[model samples]
Target: MIDVLPPWPLLGAFLLASLLLAVTPGPAVVYLLTRTLAQGRRAGLASVVGVALGNLGNAVGAAIGLAALFAVSSLAFTVVKYAGAAYLVYLGVQALRSAQAVPQQQAQTPPATMKTVFRDGFLVALLNPKTALFFAAFLPQFTSAAHSPLLQSATLGAVFVAVAATTDVFYVLMASLVAGRVRRMGRARLWGRYATAGAFIGLGAYTALSGSRGKA
Candidate 1:
């Protein structure tokens, strides 16, 4: 196993890049933060694991040839991308409606069970064209021609997911910490709801409207 792995220099560089990218907030971060702010740490953490698993799944697909399939078909990419965008929009609308429907006192009602959070997070990450394209493009660069590309890609993807999961836990903690203060203020709570909805909608629109991702 060790012999098949990438050299230390390549692995080190990949890990560093993954760390930096993971810390910088993206759509996944927004989703986790919203869950934390609206619900609590447990919900947020469940989402983290779900998204991480989804990402790992994508990396595995890329290792196996999903990247090649997409590379060969632009229409396929467009279809998947729009489907993901639509899902995000649906979530945003759902969030807005939930905010209005749930009474302030009923905040005790936990709508996001761990399984629900995990499922949503998994679908969100899995359906995201950006995430799929990202792994397709990103993983191949660090692989060595001397080794089996599939093995190298799998190892790199696993490492990337692990590092990303760590960073996600950090964001969950930070979001949860501020959640208490936000909960105390009615106005803050309302606006936070808006912010989460807006973030999801904005990202969805962007995904729906964007042109084809340049290869890699």
Candidate 2:
């Protein structure tokens, strides 16, 4: 497997770039943080797993030339991108509605089940076609011409996903620690829910309005 990768220098550069990208806050990080604050550490971790799997699926799609299809077909990319954005907005709306329905006494408890949280996370990641495009555009930079392109791309994509998952886990842990304090204050908890909902809505709007180019 090592032989299929680029030279040591290029590999090191790739690792460094991946780490930097993983640490930078993105849609995934925002979603995880909100999930952690609203639910708990377990839900946040489950979301991480779901998102990782979804991202892995996108990486595989890139390896198999799905990203190439997206590159050439604007309609395909737009359709999937809008779908993901709409879902995020829907989640935000549902959160707001739920917040109003639940009594203040129960505001501290997580309203959604783990399965729902994981499924939402999975859908959020999977529906974003730009992720596959990103893998297609980014992975080839560190791949060697002498090796099988498929193997190199797949390996690099997996490595990037692993790095990203590690960072996401760290974010979840930190958010969980802070969540205890946030939950203690009734007004704060209510406001946290509103903030979470707003974040989701804002992220969705940004995703919908942002340029179509593959962004890290």
lDDT of 2 by residue, 1-216 (tens): 776677789889999999998999989999999999887899999999989988988998998899999988988888989999999999999888877877887775656888998998898898889899999999999887888888888888999999999999999999999887887887888887788889889879988998855563
List ranges where model 1 is wrong by over 4 Å.
Answer: 103-109
TM-scores for all predictions: 0.91, 0.94
For model 2, the stretches where C-alpha displacement exceeds 4 angstroms are 108-110, 214-216
Q: Write the per-residue lDDT of candidate 1 for residues 74-178, one digit (tens) a residue.
A: 887778778878888988887788778777766544566789889888878877656666787888888878889888888788889999999999999988998
Q: What is the C-alpha lDDT of each candidate?
A: 0.81, 0.88
lDDT of 1 at 143: 80
Q: lDDT: which candidate is best? A: 2
